[model samples]
Target chain A: MKIAVLSGKGGTGKTLLSVNMAVIGENTTYIDCDVEEPNGHLFLKPKEVIKEKVAVKIPVVDMGLCNGCQKCVEFCKFNALAYINNKLMVFDNICHSCGGCVLVCPEKALTEKDKIIGEVQKGVSQGINVLSGILNIGEASGIPIIDKLLGEEPKNSQKTIIDCPPGSACIVMESIKDADYCVLIAEPTVFGVHNLSMVYELVKLFNKPHSVILNKCLDGKNPAEEFCIENNIKILDKIPFDSELGTLNSNALIAARESPKYKKMFSEIFKKIIEEAQHEAAVNP
Target chain B: MKIAIPVNDKSLENGVCQSFGRAPYFLIHDIESKENTFLNNSAALSRGGAGVKAAQMIADNEVDALLTPRCGDNAAGILKVAKIKLYKTEGDSIEDNIKAFNEGKLSPLMDIHPGLHDHGGR
Candidate 1:
């Protein structure tokens, strides 16, 4: 079974929840899909990881075979190809790597070249296998890296927990597409409520079985609780804000490692997810 | 000769729009006939390539010159390829900028600005 952990906005404790659950969850394999700023590793501290560079196919123009027809320039929707000062200028940041330029080139001047955009690391953390993709800075988007990671996911019998990036973008969609269940980590703030609704809409559009895990549930009823109740969305677990856990999180340590309470909570959360997933499978089947 | 001016409104009084790509409308004034017409800058609604689309619109109109506060590199490339002389906005009012163009007071725009990622304009 595959479970994806995501949030509408960043700093909503997605990594915290995912990393803790992955460490305590039974026979779990964790994959961090947030290529832009993956921090799950900071907590997991996996050892003896194998690293591989992630590359995207960017267009390379063979000027010798070229006529200055500007056909490729006209075909690019991103305006990444430009005919400037009697030469072709490529804005790689704007390029979506669609390879339309290669096909539209009447002069046969375009060829695809691999450009390294990120790296993926495979490691083992406390008997749990972890895979992560990290995008190079100023790469415009992390969708390509995320796509590559998901496309090449290691096949295993272990229960998979995918840690997705913030926002309901193409990258986020790519992460949750194959998930059997989605765990949306949300806070109790105003922005949290707004973004949670937006992400929930996307998850619902995908028709995936999803539930909310309200992180840092404060002293009283917050906006997240009210929104979830009104929408009839299930609240899987409510992990209260703890100062000691915050300190451990700040130090890049998983709270479950030092505290028995967090360990039991993570285990319970994992068990609840499994039970719900199995129940849904049985009913849907 | 004809010129294009990015405008806040279709009228002559409104100041030139700050960015070229996402301008609301372009005021095309024909120097020979002393006649003016407004063309909606449809590129303003595009998610991407607004600069390229706007440049193509102005170029297709056969404008001799373009006046704007800023032109992104992509738009500048298209305008240059079309052989349209790009001029910097000399004043807030389109009427004044047109007068400055007639007097040869406005300098040609050369510095290329960065692309505005969104439809929001100046």
Candidate 2:
């Protein structure tokens, strides 16, 4: 079973819950799809790391081989190409790697070349396989890296935990495309409620079975929890606003690994996730 | 002899559009002829790289210079390659900026924004 954990807003304890669940869940592989700024490796601290570069095809114009038709420039929907000073100027950062420009060029001036956008790191941490996608700075998008990270997973092997990037963009959609169950992490602020609704709508649109994990729970009225209740979304668990966990997390320590209480709590959550996923599959499939 | 200014509307009475890439219309004015033509900015609704597309449109129109409040780096690069000079507008008035350009009163737009990518997402 594959479970994707995501949140609309950043710094909402997505890493905390996912990292802990991966540690406590047996036969699990943790894959971090937050290629822009993946921090799961800092907590996992995997050993014997293996790195693989991920690249995408971008158009390279051969000035000598062509006539100035302006076809490639007009063909690009992203406007990644332009005709300037009687030469075709290709913006590598703006290209979406659709390869339409290359195909549209009748003069054969455009050719594709591999541009390294990011890499995937695979390693083992405490018997759990940890994988992370890291995108190079100044890159347009991280979807390609996320694709590579999730595509390389061993088929039908064991429990896979996907730590998705923040928000309901294309990158997040790509991360949760193959997930059996989705866990939406949310906070207690009004801003948190707004963001939670965004992801909730996204999951519903994708038709993925999902539940909410309310993080940083306080004694007062919790907006995030209220949202889940109003929407009839099940609450998987609630991680309280505690300083012990905060200090450990700030010091780059996994709470589940350092504290037995956290380990026990996460184990129960993992069990609930497994049961929910199984129930969903039996009913839907 | 020909210059361009991003405008909110086709009329010269309207103020200049704050955003060059997403502007609704561009007023191309020929200094020697004193004739003005407002070309609709088709790149206004582009999903991404609107500035680049807009710059390409300006270049294709054969404008010698551009009078605007600001421009993005990608658009600036295209204009630089097209040999189109960028002049910073003095105020929101499109007609005034055009006059300022003819009188050599406008300064070069030195600072180019990094572009607001995914503004509503965060």
* Candidate number of the best DockQ: 2
> Model 1: runs farther than 4 Å from truth?
A61-75, A82-90, A104-109, B29-37, B56-65, B76-87, B101-113, B118-122
RMSD of each: 3.5, 2.1
Kindly report the docking quality category of candidate 2: medium
Query: Predicted candidate 1: what Cα RMSD to the true structure?
Result: 3.5
Question: Chain B alone, TM-score of each model?
Answer: 0.92, 0.95
Top model by lDDT, which number? Answer: 2
Model 1: per-residue Cα lDDT at residue A33: 96
TM-score per prediction, in order, is 0.86, 0.95
Candidate 2: regions farther than 4 A off: A155-157, B117-122
- Residue pairs in clash, model 1: none
B56-76 per-residue lDDT for model 1 (tens digits): 788778898998889987788
Model 1 global lDDT (CA atoms, 0 to 1): 0.85
